[model samples]
Target chain A: MKQSQLIKGVLEGCVLAIISQGETYGLMQALHHHGFPSLVGGTLYPLLAKLEKGGDIVSIKKPSPDGPARKYYMLTPQGKETFQNFQHQWSQLSGHVNQLIDEVHSNDENPGHPG
Target chain B: MTKTQATLDEINRLTEQLAPADQAYFTDLQLYLSTAGLFYDEAQLNDQLLNMLLDLREANQHGQSARAFFGNDPQTMGNHLIQQFPQPKLRDQLGLFSLLLGISWVFQILSSPQTAGGLSLNLVAFILVPILEICAIILIIRILHTSIYPNNHHQWWPYLLTGLIVTITISLIVILNSWVTVGWTFLIPDPWHTILLAAMAIGATVYLLGALLHRWRHHQA
Candidate 1:
């Protein structure tokens, strides 16, 4: 599958995870820092809007020290709950996937060792 | 000014700060986003657009081009963004329809030629023409919105051809309207004609002022 298609499923939770930290630009910075450099404002802003619409997050426009007011995003109580749930689900899914991959690699290394 | 207007003003001011190339790209995106969705939550859409614009400006300051900061294909991105907006309520659509119908009805009354006997109007034309005109307008807007994008490189001939077809179609409809005078004629006597025109003008002015005031107050709230 295309990497973008794979990311599409978890991007909402990833975004919520970032916004849970604080601020809008930090979400972009964090995503880039974590290796998803292709995700830009075009993708991020819409996801942010969707999260806001869903009541998972909220933003307040505050005056920035450098320039005009910036929208600072924060997790609502609902958003926090949703993010915690995501964390639990991701951990379980990743653990299972990793165990299966390790088994496949071991089987490939030791040919004819099935049972 | 309403908050919406204030947000719009801020958007205009910040849009000027973009580099020429970036400005053009942003303008095309703005036009598409604003026009493609007719009845969405306008205030929220503007707010989000402003937020995006601000981010683009910051990225520009860091020497990143708009296409680099905001993806290459605006059409796809715009469609995705528009989907996040709340859909328009039925009442909003009906409100806009009524407003257009009311304004067009008044305009037709004022522009039609008067005669010695009275102001003659075709009842059929009065209702049908406005509806047809509204449909034409929506069609034109849709065409214009779809045809516009920063990367579209088709020649001008197609646009010119489309414009010609639209003009001819509307002209034919109008001419056809004028010829229908059988059971559809309505006449107002001279005194009532004057009174009707005066009343319509006054009503339009009052309604416009009231709407503006309400919007301003709503923003203040």
Candidate 2:
């Protein structure tokens, strides 16, 4: 609870979801809108490598106009299915979370959750 | 802006933190981002899809684990303390061995008297320097044993540099000693000096052989 298992689940969900598409370049950029550069080397490479090795993700090389060739990691057909499964689980979990958020009422004057 | 540009922007900041030489790996990272944007969020998804495909290719190539290849763990929030750096115990062992050998060399010299003149010089060189060189070579062998093979943790190029430097340093010490004193030996006696030189030569030979053995092990791995 202290670590927020939900966050890890959400991250895996989001990462897996990205792979569901054909392929990707920088996941941080795609997911940056959610929260990205916030977790750089610490969370990025090892996760990407693991996801690739796990057989849920596949990475390849494609030439880049700006620089050298870029490695693109894409979710396989299997990865797409995984993404859907995680998505489904997340949806149900988020619904309950949303209800909880809605139930908690706070005065406009004290929104920060203080004494 | 275009999706690629927008996605590139978000990740480029994080990419900046990596070393300049590793830029290509970042491009692959960019590709990963572009793919994920297609999916919004879902309840549950299969986690092993991409990995399974990669495994097939890497299987022929012999798949390397994240911990072995990148020295990192992906399951947690940040880099695991164990994965981020080199093993400390090995370095500690090397340092301890160096200290002990240096002390032993000093003690050996202090206790042994200067037998002859040039003989003394040859004796000390044959005796003392080999201890230092032996310890250094042993340490190098230990490091390379753990550092090479199917899943080397370190970048290989730097190890080459360390080996070259260690060899030259030991050679320099020997050459300088010869220049200052009675040639190769301590001028003990005519024939004994030759024998002593031969012994010193043997010490250098053993040290060089040890280095070669280490290199061979590294290549095989």
Candidate 3:
């Protein structure tokens, strides 16, 4: 699958996780460092807008030390709940996929000895 | 002054190297976001995008050519922006009314007014004139309440009132002297004369009724 498609699937949850700590421009740097190096304002702002529109997050303007004032996003209670559910689903889905891969690997290794 | 401010200025300068279409893409995105009620300043958004462009430029220098341009389809983004506001029903209706009124008015101007008798009313004009007049009035009323033309609510009242007064006065003169002798059609030809007279009558009634209703509402208020 395309990296962008993978990122698209979980970017919302990742954003929620980052925002849970604090809202900062540092979030952009963190996203870049954490595997979304190509993620730009074009993608991020629209995602943020959709989140705000959905009532999953809210923002307020705060003075940034470096440049102009920045809009800081904070998750609502509904957003937190949604993120927790996402985490739960991710854990289960990833675990099942891992097991399936492991089983496939073992079967390949023992292909000649199959009864 | 500050290190960060200097860096931002550098970033802004570097962003100028972007193609005009790319720059416009960013500009339009900023506008859409602002109109959609995003609270962030436009400069901040521009800065973030600029930083991304710088990163791509750096990568390109190192032999990796990432498309710095934001590849999102503008139409989809426009749709998202439009979803923020309710559908503008009055504006949409006015748009359709204006089109039909325009078509009928054009037909009136083109069709010959000189028939079996000296001066004859074309049957098409006879039917279309009333509909055109009614649609025009409705459009004016809608525009007065909340202008679809200017898109500014504050200036609508003045424009509406002035338009109403002028249309009514001219319409009154035309209606009163429907049979006045004309030496020449002059600048405009024969059919245009009847068309203008009909237009005046329609415009006058529309203005008079609009003024009365407006005054009545103001008095109530």
Candidate 1 lDDT over residue span A1-115, tens digit each: 8888888878888888888776665477678777787888778877888888899999888887876677889899999999999999999999998999998998999989962
lDDT of 2 by residue, B60-88 (tens): 24433323222232223122311322223
Q: Can you tell me the CAPRI class of model 3?
A: acceptable
DockQ of each: 0.66, 0.08, 0.23
Please write out the lDDT profile of model 1 over residues B21-67, one tens digit for every residue: 88888888888888885677778878888888888877888788888
Summarize candidate 3's per-residue lDDT along A1-115 as a digit string, tens digits: 8888888888988988888877644455568778898775446656766777788887765665654445567889998998899899889988998999988888899997532
What is the lDDT of every predicted structure here?
A: 0.81, 0.50, 0.58
- lDDT by residue (B1-221, candidate 3, tens digit) is 43445445655665566556655554454344334322233344444444445544444455443334344454354344445333345665566667666655555544535543334444444354646465455555444423322335576575866587558744743452343325322134456666776886797689899989876875685
Model 3 CA deviation exceeding 4 Å by range:
A112-115, B1-22, B28-69, B81-221
Candidate ordering by TM-score (highest first)? 1, 3, 2
lDDT of 2 by residue, A26-46 (tens): 565566555542434345555
Per-residue error for A71 in candidate 2, Å, reads 0.2
Off by over 4 Å in 2: A1-6, A106-115, B1-221
Worst 10 residues of 3 chain B by lDDT: B177-186
Chain A TM-score, cand. 1: 0.90
Better of 2 and 3 by TM-score: 3
- Residue A91 of model 3 has an lDDT of 95
Top-lDDT candidate index:
1
